[model samples]
Target chain A: MHYTRDNMAGLLRSHDINPTHQRIEIAHALFSRQEHLSADQVMAIVNTRHSETSKATVYNTLKLFLEKGLVREVIVDPSKVFFDPNTSPHHHLYEVDSGKLSDIDAEHVVISGLPPLPAGMVTEGIDLIVRVRRTS
Target chain B: MHYTRDNMAGLLRSHDINPTHQRIEIAHALFSRQEHLSADQVMAIVNTRHSETSKATVYNTLKLFLEKGLVREVIVDPSKVFFDPNTSPHHHLYEVDSGKLSDIDAEHVVISGLPPLPAGMVTEGIDLIVRVRRTS
Candidate 1:
């Protein structure tokens, strides 16, 4: 989504998130890129432009974004978690060697035969990641 | 696999992992339990029996185990990573509220329609985790 500062603020407002300067800057850092980024990566990018955003703010804002349904967390690696700006339902392709991520459009992939959920459990989400490595 | 101490040592030797006292203890801690455990959880369990095993040893041994294909890392939660002693290809069901993980037999789940890999990339593995919450 093309987001100017005003539109970014509006997006946050619509989600009932307070559009603070730090939140808007973080939103810009995420939406402006096509890649999924870790919270540390988000902090680095946000600080590159807005020098005042703290690491704590980045972490807090991301938790808020996740709770507000503005972003999704991708956990392909044990060491770091990636934050995805695209809220649309989809899967992922993770490049193992370089730790890069790409989207697998939800429309293209088909998954079936998930066993019946244990009694009294409802699905919150499904994460399907296909890990890949660059051919030498 | 039923692992007496000698069998655990043999298992390590078969995998080319040195059957050090610490590695053996770590192996027993994981293989003896049916549930997936994080490194901290592994350390906690190991230390309960053998107080000398340090955190670094747990981390290093897990990395070694992952490289040797003796364990698989489950990445369902962003907050912590779980290690599965059952190395066979399978998927998982994560109980979000309780953080419990259960295996989904690989043969039972079927997936298709993965997009063609980007040029010069080969598939490594695929991870499918269905996240669920209790219906109260």
Candidate 2:
């Protein structure tokens, strides 16, 4: 994806978001960075450029972005929440030491043969989380 | 997978956990039930029999069971956490209406062939959640 400022603005506009200076800067930081970040991390970066950005705003913006499908919220660690700019279907590789996250591009991870829906219930979605730890 | 009381007590003993009355009752409630339950739900049932069963103890027992790999935690919904008794490698189907979870026994959903790991970063695991809405 192109990381140009205009491209980011246009992307936000396409989602009907106002593309404010704070939102644009936040989007750029998220898209430019290759690592997964929490709201605090994003706020830390955005605050350097825009001192007026509040923690509540950052939290709200992230929630809005999540609702718009612009980003994905990951809860690999129960204590912390991570956000990913890549919204495509993929998996994540969590780092135990640094508490970081990376993408897993697998071709054979499609789930099938689901059991019939429970009585008076309809199926919504399937979630798979594979936890791995270092062998050494 | 014998669903009898003695069989479950034996199973717990096999896992090296002391099969106390509370533990056995919790195990039976989880194994016999067909739906995913949260700690609150487990406590609700456990309290019906033993009025002294506190929520804290139920929570602690659940944690112990999870550490022993006897149960799994499902987080399809961000607001509440759910517990699954199935320990095998599998996925989950979440119900949107009731926020219920069911096991998906697909064998072909293993994720593989991801990008190379970054320096000082080790892959831990992957979490895949597919959200489904009603058609009507």
Candidate 3:
């Protein structure tokens, strides 16, 4: 999904977030590619266009996006966390060797025998990460 | 799986890890309870017996355990990493509110619709973590 500046602005606005220049740049970096990216990767892409955003801003913006439901976080690796632009209900295919991530259609995957929620606890969300490596 | 000191020693030997005092204590802390715990939690428990281990030791030992396949790392939270002693192929139920983690029998959970592996990529491992919160 290609996201123009206006489209990204509207997205942030709809999520009740101020469409600051930095936020817009971060959103563009994520929504434009429609792929999973880490904060460092996002910063790298954002800086590639000569638009400088502080590391603090990148992390804070990502956190804000997550809180506002504008993006999702994928936790497959211990060292780094991935941010997904597609906030819809979906899973991930993580290449362990290369540290690459791809989307998995949630509709296509089936889960069964999920035990009932423990007492007093509700189901918030489920993260299904399929870690894969090179066939060689 | 009850793990006594001897059992832990045997496990380390089987995995080619020298059964040092700290490693054995760490292993016992994990295998004895069979629950997902963070390094801090493990350290807290290990130090309870007055057998103190440095923070670096705890972190390093956990890393070593992960590499040796004696434990699994769960990265649901970016700030703190959880380690699971049950090295068997399985999934997890992560309580988002309390940070509680429980095991989901690998046999009970099933996954489908995995995409074709990228060229030259092999299947490493899959981590399915179901994040939940309290109902109240």
- TM for every model, in the order presented, reads 0.94, 0.78, 0.89
Docking outcome class, model 1: high
- TM-score, candidate 1, is 0.94
Q: Give the lowest summed-lDDT range of ten residues in model 1 chain A.
A: A43-52
Give the best candidate by DockQ: 1
Worst 10 residues of 2 chain A by lDDT: A121-130
lDDT of 3: 0.87
In model 2, chain B matches the true chain B with a TM-score of 0.85
All candidates: DockQ = 0.81, 0.34, 0.71
Candidate 3 chain A: worst 10 consecutive residues by lDDT? A127-136
Q: Write the number of the candidate with greater TM-score, choosing between 1 and 2.
A: 1
Q: What is the lDDT of residue B55 in candidate 3?
A: 90
What TM-score results for chain B when candidate 3 is compared with the true chain B?
0.92
Q: How well is candidate 1 docked (DockQ)?
A: 0.81
Q: Give Cα-based local distance difference scores for all models.
A: 0.89, 0.73, 0.87
The sequence of per-residue lDDT tens digits that candidate 3 reaches over residues B79-131 is: 88999888888888888877777888888676766666667766677777778
What would the per-residue lDDT of candidate 2 be over residues B55-112, giving only the tens digit for each residue?
7778888898988888888777666677888877667666566564566674755444
Pairs of residues at least 3 apart in sequence or in different chains that clash in candidate 3: A122-B135, A133-B121, A133-B122, A134-B121, A134-B122, A135-B121, A135-B122
What shift in Å separates residue B133 of candidate 2 from its native position after superposition? Answer: 1.7
Instruction: List iRMS (one decimal) for every candidate.
Output: 1.2, 4.6, 1.6
What are the per-model numbers of colliding residue pairs?
0, 2, 7
For model 2, the superposed segments whose C-alpha errors exceed 4 Å read: A1-7, A48-51, A106-129, B1-7, B107-128
